[model samples]
Each structure stands twice: as structure tokens, then as C-alpha cells.
Target chain A: MTNKTEKKGFSRRQFLKASGAASAVAGGAGLGLFGYEAGKDPRTYRGWENWEGVNQVFNRKKYAVDQPTCQKVGPTRRVDARTEVIFYRRGSFMRQWREETGLEGMEPHIQEYYRKNPEDLELDIYSQEVIFPKLMEDRKKYQDQFRLSDAWSNAMGAVSPPRITEPPEVSDFPRRSRRGGSTEPVKFKDPKKTSKLIKKIAHELGSTLVGIAKLNPDWVYKYTSIGRGFQSDEPIEVPKHWQNAIVVGTPMSWDPMYANPNYGTSNDAYSRSRIIAFRVASFIKQLGYAARPHTPGTDYDLMVPPILVDAGIGEQSRPSIVVTPELGLNFRPAIITTNLPLHPDKPISFGVQDFCDHCKICAENCPSDAISYGDRVEVRGYLRWQVNTAKCLNFWNSTLGSMGCRLCVAVCPYTRKSNWIHKAALKVTADDPTGISEKALTMMQKRFYPGPEPQKYYIPSLGGENASYREPPWWLRTEDFIE
Target chain B: MQFFISGWFWFLEGILTCLMVVGLKFYMEDKGIPMPFWKWILFGLWILLAGFTIAFVGTSLGEGEPTAAKLGGILFGLTSTISGIALWRILLTGRNKT
Candidate 1:
């Protein structure tokens, strides 16, 4: 045979004996997978079927917040002044029709009701105006029961740095410093005295949610890099000047983030957080103060549970992460620290704990089985749900190419899009705090919605050339547009 | 002897590897060879290293020295040339009819 023919027709036996052995040696030396055995073959692609570990790597113990905190953080409502009214009534006649019909309709009575009771709709007689205030009152009343502090109230009134003159006993908590205190000290401060200006600036920089809280060492991991203040042989002392933290959250786009599970989706989220961190930190620095942006690669400090809870952003849920009411687990967070005085937002509770007690969509959908199935257990002086970090991380390592698995977050019922119908159920859930909310949520998941579908994997760089799952650019082809 | 090899060439190897992987995935798909998970694992590692190499070289090539993050923003651009060339070649060749 010719040389080309000889090479093309090479036997598997000969290939195995010569090149395969060499490739195995090189693969072992390079990536450290065990040298390929003669008969042991490996499967190429299992896609989401073999994917596990969505919860493990991210939900590890040191990072896990208590479950009640998760619940408290999850159901937080956006306190926008612009509220929508679905049903309106004019006077006793409209009220009687509402009682009689029990539904919204453009009946003559309803139309007359709208004409007469436009002011009543403004008054929001049918719905309570002070739901947030009521929830805050309830949260304060049950603070110790929930294993929380009154950090929100304390962080208010802080416009300038906490000087020797302004409230000397800044509520005795020896945590990290405000400005990388000697590179790694606790920098948490009274949530009350944080800067409203900083909060506004953070919002301008794309932060939809913001909060402030005092630092706590226990909330931080037991150990971290010396640069990060988990624990170091170096002497740990709280900074004298720096106190108070500004927690900022940038909500992920609900549509793309929920649909795409991999880093492609999350990388964009992380990138946004990094951007917000830079902007907020820089703004503080411009005001002739010290501001540190706590982000993944940039910050020198560690983020504990306070950033989520103290901000009234969301509650911690079954997956041991803060769940926002509007976007669920579809957001990334960062923190800024300085001496700027500002008002801190109070912790919010919208019945997420009671809601999660009956809802386990995330737990059911976790491919790695890393999320817990048991009841809330106490860990690190707080009762909370816990996930197996090792299992989650292993799954991440296994599925390197496909977007890192986010099956748990994707399947979360709370992560659904905001619509009027859902708002009604949520309002009732907030009012009751009973398992009715959970049942409604479950019914919504089971009866109203289709089951979880696997996320698709396609190479973005390859675009439409490889698989046809590319996100089409704005301009459609003439053929596609015509159809 | 090791110093004789250009660092740019290491990066070029990475760029070529990425392009070849793309080609291989398409080529193998047309030929019906199921790609193993290791191919993807290798893909991630190579992409990361290539990114690092670009940042390191780009920093030294500049006046103030660019950060890895800044370099990361443009690493895809640099690789786009080779990948784009490969894509253009494929476009010119028309669809593979395997």
C-alpha cells in the first residue's frame, strides 16, 4: 500500500501499542488523570444527566448562612412607591358587588366603582399600604427568635464616620476594620450610620438592592487567607476608625440567567457585580474617604451573611443562599466599606421561611443531591439549611465545558417572572405566614407550570456554526425575518 | 534552549489548540465520533491558560502595564482572528457533506 493508505488504514491494535500509550503518558503528565487503561473506556458526553454539584462548591459550610436568615432574606419586597391596583371599588355599591361577584369584572357596578372610587384606589383600601412597615415591626419583635440583631436600626443616622463624639460604644462588636485594617481585620459597622449618598451611588451603578450591617467574625469563615481575615496567625484587631458596611446587590436578568445554567450566564452576573463594586468603591474614595469594593478577585475582605440580610434584599432559603422575592437566586452581590454616615435598611421578612417550609423545588431539582432534604439544623450558632459542598464542587469539576450547573436556582419557584397573578398569591402569602403560601406555591409549580427542563449547552464562540442554539443577534437574516 | 522558544508561540499554541478543538468538534460531529468529556476539560484549561498568557504579554507590551482583567476583555479578540480565519475558511469551503 502507499504510505498515505498505510497511515489511513492503521489498525486499532497497532495504534494502541504505539501512539495511544504515548498519549496516555502525556495526558497523565499534563492533566493528572490516571493513565488510560487498555480496556477501560470513558463516556464522552452525558450533558445534564451526569451533572452534579451545583450546590456543593458554592454552598459550603463556611459560606452557609442559617436557614431562617435565608427565609428572611428571600421574600423581601421592593419598596417602590408606584404600586399597581388590580381591583377597585367606588362606594358601598362597588363593595357589595365585590363581595357578590368575588372577581374583577367591568360590570356596570365595577365601572361605576372605578369612576367614583378613583380616590379609594389611591387610598388602597382593599390592600394594606404599610405591609413593609408591618413586616419590619414583626421582624424587630422576633429578632432574637430569628437569631438576628437590630443592626439595621444601629446603622441608620450614620452620615459621617463614627468619630469619638458620635455614639462612643458603637454597639460593642469586635470585628474587622473599615479600611483593610492592617490588611485583614473585621470591618462591619452599625447599619444605621451608613451613607444614603453611598446607597444612591451604588444604585446609580446598577445596584437594585442595598443594605448595611455590623461586621461579625463568626459570620465570616473560620479561616481565610491572611489577606482576607478568615483567620491568620497575625494578631486580629478591629480597626478604630473604619466601621459600617454597604451591601449592594445587582439582580440578574431573569430570562437569560434562569434559562442558561453555565458560567456564560453567571460570568455575566459576576462581571456586573465586579463593575458595581468598582463604581461604588470609587465613588466613596472620591468623597475623600476610604471605600473598599468587596468582590471576587478585587476585595481584601470576606462577605458574610449580613450583606444580604441587613440590606432587606432577600431571605436565606433551603439552598443556604439569600433568595430575593423579585428575582430569586438570580443576582450577584458585593459590599463597600467606609466611615460615611448613612441610613441602613431594616431586615425584611415576607413570609419566606413559612413559604420554604413547604416548598422544596430547589432541593428536588439539584442534580448533585448536594442540597439538604432534612429540616433546618443549627450550625455555627444559627439554625439553617446546609448543602454538601464537596459533592457540589466535584460536579463542577466534572462538567467543565457546559455552563456550571445551576439546576437548583433554575428550578426555584420563587425565581419565576413577576406577573399580576403571582403578585396576588404573594400578597396573600405575606398576610397569612401560614403554609397556605407554600401550598399555593406548590400548586403553582405542579399544576400551573411545566416541569424543569435541562439547560442547553452550546459554544458561544462557535455561535450558529456548531449547534443551532446560538443566541441570535438583533438583526435577523432575510429568510428568517420573512418567516 | 527553553529560552529560545517565544512566549508568544506558547500563546499561539493555545490559540491554535482552541481553533483545532472547534474544528475537531465540528469535524468529528460530521464523522460521528462522540467527543469525550475530557475534550471539554482540556478546552477549559487551554482557554484559561491562553487568557493568562495574553494578559502577561499584553501588560509588558504596554506603558502602564494592563491588568489581567483588562487583558481578558481582549483575549477573545486576539483568538478571534484565528477562529475567524477558520470560520471564514469553512464558509468558503461550503458545508461539509460527510
Candidate 2:
């Protein structure tokens, strides 16, 4: 047999050297391009700074508060002012829907699904045996210190809202520093400086993304539900003077999120956000302002997406969630409402709407088909793509394998790690404004990372799990230390 | 049975299987074997089915065993299948291609 290498006049060692040199050149060129796209400053591509000035120009132009989009009062009402979907009212739907479905509730429904498919049940069992116990242990260790509420205990009105009894206490030092031992508010004359300082403080205290927004009454919930049963429906009266909101978002780990819809990574992200929010709220309170932290497991006074949008943190996407430029949908936001004087950020327009319009990946991948494939509709006064909440919740409740279905968040092309390629694509899409760059980027994403097959039962593999989670580093595993 | 009960042993078995498959692929390529892509895919499917069967049988028979043992059994089965599949694909791709 003729030797292919000799026939081609290239030895293996010579070929390897040539290829190595070529790869080195290619790698250098790629890094150079990435450096240029990232900007001259190294900090622009590092940590929370990636979001700095990301969609500033576009946001200032299109979705600014003074813009026509914000000016118009449509049929679906602006999210900030929409009063129809109160917390208790929304909670009531779970019971009503459970009756409608004729299933006992989510647990029974999940049990039925597993019973029908023993193989899937086996997979679930394997995960429970291998993965969930450790996750639960970690959660138990951190639950008291990190989480302030237990809204996730029951998705229905059975545990609608957990009550907050004590008011946020201001620090003794700040209170004593004031004249006559009375707490006098430390006022900032410059809103811009205050906003910058607040953002810096938030970032330092573990916030992945932070922004400020002028408080909108429409965002506040009409009533808060505290605990289950009759006493749950308590009317909440938020003081109008709480004029500014400090919005902070913490990004979840990509590895576990990619691994499964609901996992330790998702829960950990929420816990971390709660801790960050609590600290931020306490910090604001020390400044002599009443600051209330609103986290995932807490009763929310304000709708998060609109507040995030108005804060210039992200744009509203098709899944009816805020998609940040830096983290995409892989983030959980916590809000701190305060009377602190701060300048609100302009709402960004980073072509998320355009990208979501073209990429129906989320809608297609939705387990229960809860996401809408159609154009943006006026729902509760906001002209945006609205998901079928009932259907979405039903899926969340019924999924025995996972806690919640974050398939949309997991599948989003934008929800990628902070790599240069993704960053470059983001820059291109943002700069174009027109859908041209977005279309190209979407196409590239589809080609490279094609969406997972619909309804394929994800069994956590024993050792060779393709989407398995990385063992969390020592710092994250707080369970190691006994309290 | 003793090997199947040990998690680390199963894990080691998976690694060894993976290494062996890799070595086989390299050896086959050096010997100029013209393995088709579809054949590799078919072989992978067979390996996957075999792995599934091993897991199913092990779990069913060792009902009283620790959950970790069952998990280890399933993991070893899966690892073997994945290793085989990966090797088959690597071999089919050849040295110049992928």
C-alpha cells in the first residue's frame, strides 16, 4: 500500500509543525480581533463592566422615557401601571386551574407522567439519588442565612406569600449621627453621582448587573399576599415617596443551567441574589432611607421586567422576560425600593425584540407550548410578546424531573458565557440597529448550537452525562462546614 | 458483581473503555480501515442499546443495593456506550478531517 504522507510529500512531524504554527497565527489573529471588539480598556470585557455603555447610544435614541414608545398608553397598559394581575389574584389561578385540569395538583400530575414512563422515572430516580440530595443539603445549609422567603414551597395560593413582620431597621450609627437623635436622610444633590455610587456599591456586593430607575406606581402590586388561606390577601400601601428603585441582577452558572431546567445552580443564583439584595437594602437604609429588598422568593411590590427595562439593564424579550446584553436571560434580579435620590437610566434597545422575532427557538422548545409564536400583543397594557401564564405555570407545576421550566432562558442564543465571539456578535447586533446583524448572528447561533430536540427526556447520566454539572468549587459548597 | 457494585471501579472501567476505544480507532486508521460514517453511527446505537440494557438489568436485579451502586451501574454502562460511540465517530472522521 502506498503511504499517503509520502505520496503528498509531507511527513507527520513536518505536518504537525506547520499546522501548529498556522494555529498559533490563527489564535493570535482571533485574540487581536477580540481585543479590538472588546475595546482598548481591559476592564470593558471584565466582570459587570461588560454591561457598561453596552446599549447606551441605542437606548438613549429609541426607548428613552421621553420616546414615543413610552409616551403611548396602549390597550395592554404599561407594566409599571398595570393593576389587573395582582399577586393574590394571580395566586388564585393555580387552584382554579388545578380544578379545571381535574388533577389533584402538580405533584399528582407529575406522578402520573412518571408512572406512564418508567424509563423517565428511572432517570429522575438516578438524578435524585446522585444529584438532588447534595443540592438539597447545600440548600438547607444556606436557606436560613440566604433566603428571607419561601414562596417556592407552593406555586399555588396554598403558600401564596410569606409575610414580612418587622420593618427594615436603619443603622444605629447613622441614626445617632443626625441632630436630636432623629434619623435625618442623607440627601444627594446630584442624581448622576448617586446613581454611579449606588451601582459601584451594588457591583462590589456581588451584583452582576445593577441599574437605577425612577419609581413608577404602575409597577407596584395593588395588594400583597402574606401566607396561605384567608389572611393571605392583605392590601399593601407602598409610600409614594419611595421614588427610586435600585435593580440588581446576578447571573446563574451556565454549566448547570445548560445541564437541566431546574438545578442547584438556578437555586444558588436566587440565594446569592437575595443575599446581595438584603445587603444593598441594608446599605441604603444606613444612608437614612427606608429600603425594602424584593427578591424571587419574596412578595414583589413592583413588576421586575419593566423596572429592569426602564433601568436600561435589558430589553423585554419574547418569553416576557428581560434579556440583558451581558448575561442574557441567565440572571435573577432583585430590587431595592428606596427614597434615595437617583437618576433613572434610559431603556435600552439592543435588537432583542428583533432577534426574538426571528428566533422562535424558545417558543419551539417550550415543553407545554406556553410561549407564543405570534407577534407582540397588547397584554395588560404592554405591547410585547406575552406568554400563556396558565400553560407555563402548569408545566412548571407538573414537571416531576425539575422544579421549574426555564427552557426558554436555557435555550436563548444570547444566554452565553462572556466569550469574545458572543461579545463581538452582541456589538455588531447593537451597532446595526437594523435586523441585519441580528439575523446573521441568530443564523450563526443556530448553526453552531442547534436547539435541543423537543420532548427528549433528559436523564442525568451516571458518569458520561453530556449536560452534567461541574462539581461546584469549595467556596460554593457551604455544606462542608457544619453550623 | 463485585466490580458492578464499586463506583470507583465502574468509573475506572469507563475510562479504560474510552482509552481502549481510542487506541483501537488509532490502530484501525493506521491500518487504513475504510469505515463508513453510517456504520459508525449504527455501531454507536448498538452500544447505546447495550448500555441501556446493562443499566436496566443491573437496577432490576440489585433492587436491595444502595442507590449509589445502582447509579454506578448506570454510569458505567453509559460511559462505555459514550466511549464506544466517540471512538467510532473519531475513527470514521480519519486523521485529516475532524
True contacts kept of each: 0.00, 0.00
Candidate 1 lDDT tens digits, A415-440: 54443233445556656745665685
Q: CA lDDT of B7 in candidate 1?
A: 57
Kindly list the per-residue Cα lDDT of model 2 for residues A323-379, writing each as its tens digit: 887778887898888878888887777677778888887888786577999988765
> Model 1 RMSD to the real structure?
24.4
Each model's DockQ score: 0.03, 0.02
TM-score of 2: 0.57
| C-alpha lDDT of residue B12 in model 1 | 47
After superposition, candidate 1 runs with Cα above 4 Å error: A1-194, A226-242, A262-264, A297-300, A400-403, A452-483, B1-98
In CAPRI terms, where does candidate 2 land? incorrect
Error of 1 at B36 (Å): 74
Against the native chain B, each candidate's TM-score is 0.35, 0.42
> Model 1: how many Å of interface RMSD?
18.2
